[model samples]
Target chain A: MKAFAYVNATNEREVVAALKTDGIALPLAGGQDLLARMKDYIDSPDRIVNVKNALDTTVTSTPEGGLKIGAAVKIIDLYENQQVARMYPALNAAAIEIGTPQIRHQATVGGNINQRPRCWYYRNEEFVCYKKGGSRCFAVDGENQYHAIFGNDGPSHIVHPSSLAVPFAAYGARFRVLGPKGDREIAASDFFTMPTLASVLKENVLEDEEILTHVILPAPGNVRSGHYEVRYKASHDWPLAFTTVVLTMNGNRIGSARVVLGAVAPVPWRSKPAEAALAGKPLNEDTAMLAAEAAVSEAKPMSGNAYKVQMAKTAVKRAIMRAAGLKTV
Target chain B: MSDKEDRFGVSRRDFLKSAGVGGLATAVTSAGVTDVEAQAGPRVIGPGDVPVSLTVNGKRLELRIEPRVTLLDALRNRADLTGNKRVCDRGSCGACTMIVDGRTAYSCSTLAIDVQGKQIRTVEGLAGANTLHPVQQAFCDVDALMCGFCTPGFVVATVALLEKYPNATPEQARRELDGNICRCGTFVRIMEAAMKAKTVAGPPTRQARWGDMGVARG
Candidate 1:
């Protein structure tokens, strides 16, 4: 990595001041992603403001009996929390499936949500893809076995890299962002943006000087949520495709559902058709298959990633089955 | 002659001011920066060679380093501690695993300044002058290592795993060892070593020297 001035901000106000300075300054969260990007020459900042000490790192219960997770809370610590494991099982599952134990110990929630695209073309220096302001997205016609199966109508074909964002979006989590102006809350679904020609450089709506400080989840009343990820390797590999299902049941019938797919799009792709299929339907194998089919009905796979469409459908089916307390095949 | 010019001759101040190099030289010294400290604002160290004091294997050592230097580089280069290997400098291979604040962390990816106040236990601290830790002994007992390049990381991770779960099942052992990768493919024997390894009895003979630096969060 190139040399850069490092400042340890003591508080939020100091962080704001340091970030507002002229020149290229980047907030150093877990540095799991930023440091790698720096080494790869994807991003080189003139100044790095360390915010681990300046922010809160606790997991607390909100007034409405929901959970308020600080941005700096480590992924391992989140899974080990008693209330989180018992109350939010989907989050706990996602946390465990994110990376290895060492990564979870070092990575933080804020960094995970704001991680860069995992497209190999974007990471390598040889191929200057659309994310790097190049003319074309090399993954479109190049080796794209891991490219997006949805949200492909773009100049960028990278997938969202966060495992927690899937479950967080399914549960209607809101992110609290702090900037030079003030703190503003943004829904998790609205935080990630699909890649367009104008906004191909960044994946999220976070400003240069803004930091995501907190993730607030509402109460999961009369609802069951499940997260299932399909990885080729069971040990320390990114998911090929994953799904999180949050189902609210009215007695034996499903009242509403939120089915969000990860690693299939530029953002957490919410399947409205799947939710519509599950609405007021009995939680059975037939309903699960129907919902899974609806979830992947619009997936337009690239050249080499057509297999991911089936994996994405199976992930949705298994997630729904798991939520209904049924054993999946 | 102009009225503003020196009446007698080109005075010393006028001559020096017209040269322009003198002004730049004076600007350098007027900032009150001595030889040791840089002229920058605030008391913090820099992107250049800055003083960093850390405790490794119960020795509180200080070294001059840049902010981008990782803990693995600092330990290997500055302190002559080479037990932590630097394979896969990214967090992928976990070849530079160390116990920081009682948790397994990748020393290659962890900044030396980030864990300034925390307790860091490298593989060298796991054994005594003559004897070895239970996990190390178990690894030797089972002949769990082929090429020893990845031993330090595996040993450190095993030490943490035994601390968390003493009687680890096969599934638990597999989960714990996922962080460290062994290209030699000694995972079968490593699993045997984990199941047979006894609990870490007491404080390590070479305990880490932890100062009250008010632990910096990872």
Candidate 2:
């Protein structure tokens, strides 16, 4: 990595001020993503602001019976938090399935959500894809086995890499961003923007001078949620595709549903059709299969990723089954 | 040049101005002694070599290095502690796993300066002068290593696991050790060593810790 200055920020003000510098000043939380990108020369910032000590690291209960999780809370703590396990079990499941034990012990929630896409073309300095200021996405015509099947209408074909993002969207959480002017809350579903020709360099709506401070989850009332992931390697690998389902139950029938898919889109792919299929219908094997089929009905699979369509369907079906307390297999 | 100028011939005032730290500089220069820290912002350290202190194996080691130096590079290249090998420097492979503040972390992805005040433990700190740590001894007794490039990280990770869960279940052991990879396919033996070490290994006694060398003498 190239030489850079370090800033040991003590608070949010210092963090924003440090990043407001003339040179490129990036926040360093956990260093799981930023440091690796630096080593690969994908990013060469002049300053690194250490936010591990500066940001809030606790999970507190809001007056509205919701959770306000500080950005610096480690993934392990999020996974083991009893409140999260009870209230937002889909998020807890997603947290536990992240990278590995070592990664969970160090990586922070903010960093995980803000991590760059793991598209091999973007990671390798040689390819210089659209995410890297190049003309077009190499995954368009090149190897696209792990690329997106949904939301590929954009210039970039990279998948959003955060496992926590799907559940965050399903749980109706909002992200609080701290900036030089002030702080603002963005709905989790709207936080990630689809890639455009102009905004291909970034995945989320966070500005350079801002930091994501907290994730606020509204109270889950009368809801059952489940998250399921499919990966080639059971030990440690990114999921081929994953799904998180939040079903609002009205006695025996489903009142409403939120189905979100990951690794199949540039953003967390929310299937309105699947939600419509599940509404007012009793969750059974047949209904679950219908919802799964509806979830992938619009998937535009690439040359090499047609298999992911089936895997995504399986994940959606299993997520619904798991939410309903049924045998998925 | 005045004493305020850095080695790069840029005056501190100009440097601060160019770096957009004029506000912090004004605050630091104008604030009262009691109110200084409240007004002052984060202090910028190196784009050059700067002093960094680390507590490794219960001993403080100091070095002057550029801010980009990772903990793995600092320990292996500067502190002469090379037990933790750097195989995949991007934090995928766990060959550079180290225990920091009672948790196993990827040292390759961790900056040396950022971990200044944390207690760091590596594979080198596992044994004492007279006897090997129970985990190390178990690895040998079970023949859990073949090529051995990945052993130090596995040993460190295993020690952390056993320390956290004395009688770790098979699933727990698998999950904890999943970050590491062994090309020689020594996993069965390694798993056996981990289970055996759970029965034999206890917390390191006072005698089981190295005095100051930060390595086992044997």
Strongest candidate by TM-score: 2
lDDT of each: 0.81, 0.86
lDDT of 1 at B79: 88
Q: Which stretches of candidate 1 lie over 4 Å from their true place?
A: B1-44, B199-218
Model 2 chain B, poorest ten-residue lDDT window?
B20-29
TM-score of chain B of each: 0.71, 0.75
**What is the interface root-mean-square deviation of candidate 2?**
8.9
Per-residue CA lDDT of candidate 1, range B1-218, in tens? 23222432322233212211100000011222222222233233477988788887777878889988889999999888999898988888878999998999998888888778788999999999898889998788667899988988999999899898887877888898898899998888888778778544543322222475554453
- Model 1, B190: alpha-carbon shift in Å? 0.8
lDDT of 2 by residue, B109-205 (tens): 9999989999999998999988888889888877899999999999999999999998999899999999999999999988988988887845432
Model 1 RMSD to the real structure? 12.8
True contacts kept of each: 0.24, 0.39
Model 1: per-residue lDDT, tens digit, A74-144? 99999999998888899999999978989999899888898887789877755656676556899888999
